[model samples]
Target: MGDTEPRLDRGEALAATGVGCFLWVPATGQLILDPVGRDALDLLPGEYRGLAEDLRPKILRDDWTLLSGLSAALRGGLKDAYSAYFRVALHDGRSRWTHVRGNVVRDGSDGVTRVVGVVRDATLDLSPSSLRPPADEDSDHLHTLGEAAIALARAMSVREVGAVLGDELCLRRLGVKAMSLAVLEQGRLRLVRSVLSLDDAEPPQKSRLADSWPLNDVVRSARPLFFTSVPDFLDRYPRLAPHQHGFHATAAAFLPLVEQGQPLGAMGMFYENTNSFSLADHTLMTAWSRAVARALHRVTMLDRSREIAAGLQNAMLPRRIPETPGGRITVRYRTARQGVRVGGDWYDAVTLPDGGVGVAIGDVQGHDTEAAALMGQLRVAMTAYAAEGHPCEWVLAKASAFLAELGADRFATCQYLRIALATGAVHAANAGHPLPLLRRTDGTVDRLELAGGPPLGLPADWDLTPYSPTSARLDPGETLLLYSDGLVERPGEDIDRGLARLSAAFSAGPADLEELADHLLDTLTPGPHAEDDAALLMLRRDAA
Candidate 1:
């Protein structure tokens, strides 16, 4: 009772000062409201006993979804502060925009007992020109954070989580032009991911924590340090100034990445132009670090998980193209960088018992471990079916049924090719996959159009409607290109543009099968990680 008196008095003090004070008790799952708290939420004083009972009705209907999540975040069990903003429906047929800022209070066992926070009017702050920016930006930020959480939750490895961080936090969205992420692995600092302009300067010969000073110091002190200007940084760490040559960063900040007070890593963000960070900017960066640290810790453990997954996938994927009399069978596979997933893309080439070469390229739906596993199973299934001397159409039809029975939930697109090594005859079937290209002896490229069938795993039942394979003739010195959609498909773009790019690449590509494979792969992969995994398999008939 004595403790309750001071809390009530503090609430009165908050109301007297034009701010509202709120106390959320997890035991009852209720918010105790003071006079200003009621006014801030557009409620009558003493009209509500607890938040859960009276709050939902008062909240604007369209904003209920935001409110529900915000309630969790505001009471969000985090070691850091939680904040949210939303509009409340008023009695006078009006709405009030309010911002709630608070921290969760937990008992000795780390169980949240209560949440204490402040509330204030913040409608004007929602404008972009306002000091606080708009709630839309806040909403986007929250949405990205939610996505990061989801990515980490289902991540196959730490690298997948790292990919999420790079996608979310890279670039200057948060005034970070460059970022370096590193963690202590077995008493050695292992660089997780670094996006910086180091120019020709080599990496530090040693990778021990003691080798990097300010970074190591922050990890030890458990605090963030910032340098507002390049000269300021150079002046403080004179011994480290010489290494700055060609590494011209104007401003820098370092944060000790931690999880529940345990040191996990150290992260640094840099700016190219001279600048100073505002207090608000510092606060936001700190919050981002806390979130990133949790994700990165898991990435550190994913080394073996990724290795095993990669080994399994690599084993399932073809190692080399089989020798064929028609010409040479060349293939290339590139997984997306940053480890989004091992990928569901697979390519295989095998010599048939009938003196024909069977080449298959497929992309299983999804970008996770399950997708990779399913991709392996389906690839093996296709190889086995094709080996049994089945027609192209039969292989796909049987595969569709096989995956359905194998409990495959994701869909996949595949292309199968049977090339008669002696006659240069091509029989191809596309299972809702991309078209194959035929590069002529005259340097002209055309699509080998085929009747498309359903992808693997669909209808929750089965859709192996009998479909016929297509036929095309591969003349001497002519090439047939089989590729996965990742080579041509991108978001917000037409597939034709990618096809045209492929055509242009083939026209200008080397006549040699091996060089052609590398040339095409290098031309399309614009970033370190292709937007998705890309597979290229090219075959040409021998003129001799």
Candidate 2:
């Protein structure tokens, strides 16, 4: 539309109709309204000359949703023109019906970026015999609520929940200027997340619940608090007068998050120019706080549960890797990242009486407590058998038989290493386990091709063959790597591919055994969210 087109027709056809003109720029969120439009919205002449978001507190949540999505519909090519009927909160605490109609402005590239609209008082148009808003006008708010719920539900920790709530895109969609969340912990408030700030001084992360702050007051009284302007805030809390100069917000809302009559925490929202908050604003904010409280509680419990599971799993692994005087030993055990259940992967290293080191890495059949229990027992048996100076093959056989005798109806894959540090000799035994890799001093890598027996705990009739030891020599400055399948397993891909990747990583890894250990785990493991647990052991024969 031309600049003079709407003005000319508007002046001629609607001069006496009590209508007003507005031009909205989607890019900057600027909404310019003439004198009549200001009156129709019940706003003073100088009250709102900034962004459209500054009027959110005066509009109901559902109505705000309609107003915000109006330009979006035109930009998406869904419509060339739009019309909406919504209620605006009047200064006297009454809702007045308002009507707005707009047409999108497209540039030379046919891209819509601006909207030209006219607004008028629509209270009389909402009569029983008059036009009504579309039935789907309220659906937008419900959709917004549903999306937030889904994101909160998927959060695995309190930090993650905070991230979801503080997301910039989410805040933009809701027209929120700044947001802060704090939870009550043992009579104190602990800040969880803070997004966007209009204050020069940051709020303390932890504060006593009895502190003289709006958020603290809401938590104590279990009610919402609203400040219509900066002066309102200063008047209500005179003790904070000295800090008023640092606060740039024009309006603020602090809502208590209570569930089942129990107070959880509080949420604070700050706005630039919102003068008043309507009842609809109160209702919507209360509902949102309830959702946040629930999500926070759930994730807190999950994080604690995971910590407990991890503690138990750690208790079952070796407390220390006995010193290898003639070599270096580095080991790492990582639990599964997806769930609270403990996994069965474990590693053990013990200094032999004859100055050698007994190292073993294994994984049991399942990922539950039962599997973990069986792993502890099997690990002890293998350590005892190897410490007794038994051969590598004998240790595997005894451990396998011990697992079967437990009658747990489970199996385990294990690789045992008896290293003579002085001679750099490694005798490895395999029981249906991935072969150990030897990183030669020359930077080449090779697998110890040992014959594998059936996994431990199989019936005698089902056992294919006895475990066999593979003898390999590790030269000075060379390292031996033993790890569970999780270190080299990717979903829906061949094991060979993962193994190949591991080989390339190990060969090009750092020279220091300790750094090499970290390099292999960082390069080979999928991520912190790996589905399976992994235990890794690296032993390097130091040069004489």
Candidate 3:
């Protein structure tokens, strides 16, 4: 080789050849070789060598493709530039593993040139018997287990981690006939995940296991336990004898799924053919279980926090309607039946400056903390407006404008009603809500007619029509009812049906304000677990 060209020295050539077979090429599709390794290059057949030669030009043109091909050729054993490998089978029917590791070279001026690396043959079996006793195999298994643990820890859910562990470690590789993860719920073991062999003719399935099994024992003791054979396990614990016939063989292992000293569950691995679980396997599985347990605990805590928050939001709503003179008022509220969907449903009854009571009800657009907070803000704003003696239409318009200005657009629906005690007149304005029902002392019931407007949070330029409040003379024994939509609506029931039910309940009895309020709530919507928050308010005119 010329002095201008880079070349591998004697030791360098041997080190490269010893680790793996390597080939390097310049940007111009030329092979650059050191003197010592020229003889070894002749060993490859012309066809194979031609293929190698063809790679030089492509590699020079596309560095990423070149590096990826090199890495793939080396079976992922090679790392870093200046090193690469290719496994080749000789004409004599022998195969060899090779490793290549090296670095890339860049011209300081251009910052783009060619790769430079070493190739070496790294073919070693390193099986348990061939390697040093005890420590080597133990370390290898431990390393594998650590990788599995890291994988499990990155998983998003407990079920995901369980699937990965059950499939990758226990089922395919370990020759286990079956594997399962059982969670300890209220002191009893509940099967959460299971993997069974499809080839079995008469596979026995175990239901929820008792608390006295060896798996629970391991969890209670916070340790790992192994049984070399099924008979031995059964002999030690007779409770397992009845379940032994279903398993292919008696060998089993139990690892405690624990997190921060608290036992959450247990994982069990079973082998049909008898074999003892090595200490390394036990240790690795224990670590895997601990990771899974931590994930489970996190999910459980989040679910509980949501439940408590929902309860708190529900408690913030008024439990009873305020008493108003001249007319009767009753209200009901329901939350969504789905888990943790607590949201912003609010109703308020305030004594207006003119002695006419203002009744307002609204629902925010979301089922979360933001919705609840916005609801509280709107409720307070409405109360302020009512105290200022704003008419129902003006109160709604101002409130809607305020919400829009505050950037609460597209978030809420509200209905406000002003009832004058002296005149027996009910003035109402609606901003996208179900109309209230008015039941006369006679057999007839009517839907109070009111003009509808856009819900709060729309742009200020949006139309704000003054709603014409409807008026009706309150009969001596008649009742006026205001309610949130949840009262009569259910998943499969018709809206008209729900309204009819409400009307019938009101007319069924000539009840007083308190009795009517309770009757409407208890008959129409009752339960601590209402799917949506319901608010009901009723006012009755006393008989002369």
Candidate 4:
């Protein structure tokens, strides 16, 4: 009691108790202040003062327990904690904004310590200030737009660029309620990407305003529009009244995604509650839209480039059959339908110096430009080796070695067949390929089974010897069919079933090689779409 004997005055008593500047009065349920000036305390509005009075009793009884209760109440509701400014609006017409600091102070008698904290009245300066200069917000907007443009430029496809733009607008800290990107396809706007909520939450509902909202107006006019309030905007454009319900009832801005007077699409930002979009927000969004347009253009160019490259690669494959003396050889090659359209399936036939013909069919491991280029190299090498009069096995062995060296362990499947017109014999060697079909004139089919060899490009340590050449007589009225796996195989279908189907289709069809090849290409491939590339090479012997 000797330490500045407790004063009778509520304020002085709080000060003497050394419980910091603010003390909760249990009896009156109000905060009794000490030496801190009234200006700091005066920052609280009357309603919040009443709230402090109501909360004082709970705080004095439980201390920090009351803080947890308050935080739980404000979790996802309208509450904000920015820098040092924390504000929360209670159900009652009361709002609280506080500046707090704390430290540990020891109790003199027990030599034990407790944390002593102070809640100061620093609310007077809590209002948000405009840090953006007159046009500074515009500059910031341009900067963000530049970032979006760069992302789009670096994107490999249109869908990729669309993803980048959607993420930027929908994943940033601005709490954007919804966003979308549309492309002008065949004179109609097609939605490419749609994103909702800048926060990690379910996306809010959205409507396409391209037909009746201000977005369509902006896009059609190639101008940007900012709406501070939805009610007023809806009054002017009553047709959009129905779509303005829900979260779209809040303030918004529409910016046309355009470049060089051509409109690619539009970008929009929606809020949850009624408020006006600032001029800075509009400028920033407009710049972002422009950047997005540039990105879309770049993506378009990349798609065109890929298409041209794919077309050129397709042309690199053989177009027509090369006329040979004993029989006819027809080739068909289809490229992959999706992803990189580089076709790895290839077929080649060259007349040898020794009056024999060399034929090769192969498939590389991937569907990309690299795979197509490797196929080209292998085709040329096989033709050159076969024209040199090397035996079929020797050609494949040397080619396999060359591929192993060139590919550094990359692998491919190939089957090479050499036909000697003078001897009426066909010699073939297969490297991990399906057995070729021999169609006899009597509607009988035979599979020319050769011992399997290691795929081309396997290391030399592997047993390449297992793939020795097999020989068969090329009797009159027989057709030899060699093809890539895509011809008779499909997902979920057994390989035996595919082979049986191919054999039946060939046996049931006309004897014309062209007709048979067409039937196989048309009926053997599943569905209307070819999931993978298919290559076919047919060689027939003249009827005696």
lDDT winner between candidates 1 and 2: 2
The deviation in Å at residue 422 for candidate 3 is 3.9
| Model 1, C-alpha of 298: deviation from truth (Å) | 8.7
Query: Which stretches of model 1 miss by more than 4 angstroms?
Result: 1-182, 190-206, 220-255, 267-315, 336-343, 365-371, 407-412, 451-465, 510-512, 522-525, 528-532
Clashes of each: 2, 0, 50, 0
Candidate 1 lDDT, 110-155, residue by residue in tens? 2324678888776665432322222235555555445545644544
Write down the worst ten-residue block by lDDT for model 2. 128-137
- Per-model lDDT: 0.69, 0.74, 0.59, 0.62
- Model 3 spans > 4 angstroms off: 1-303, 311-330, 442-444, 491-494, 505-531
lDDT score at residue 96, model 1, on the 0-100 scale: 66
Residues 23-76 of candidate 2 have per-residue lDDT tens digits of: 875433468887777888888756786567556677754344344336334323
> Which model, 2 or 3, shows the larger lDDT?
2
True-structure RMSD for candidate 4:
24.3
What candidate 2 gets wrong by more than 4 Å, as runs, is 1-137, 195-203, 234-248, 260-262, 441-444, 522-528
Please write out the lDDT profile of model 3 over residues 1-544, one tens digit for every residue. Answer: 6678777687765755453233442222234444333323224333334223433322222112213333322211233243333333444544343344555443324322234555433345311223222323766655655665555554434444455554322233333445677666666665555443323321222333344666667767787778886567767777545544444555677778777777777787765544756656566556655666777676555456656766766666655556666655655555553346667888888878788788888888877777777787787887789779887878888888777766755458888887777677777888888887777767467777678777877776656555455555666766667676777765544576567667766665444667667667655553223455566666666655
Quote the lDDT for 133 in model 4: 24
Least lDDT summed over 10 consecutive residues: which range in candidate 3?
A: 57-66
What TM-score, to 2 decimals, does candidate 2 have? Answer: 0.69
Q: Cα-based RMSD of the predictions, in order? A: 19.8, 16.0, 23.6, 24.3
**TM-scores for every predicted model:** 0.54, 0.69, 0.44, 0.46
Best model per lDDT: 2
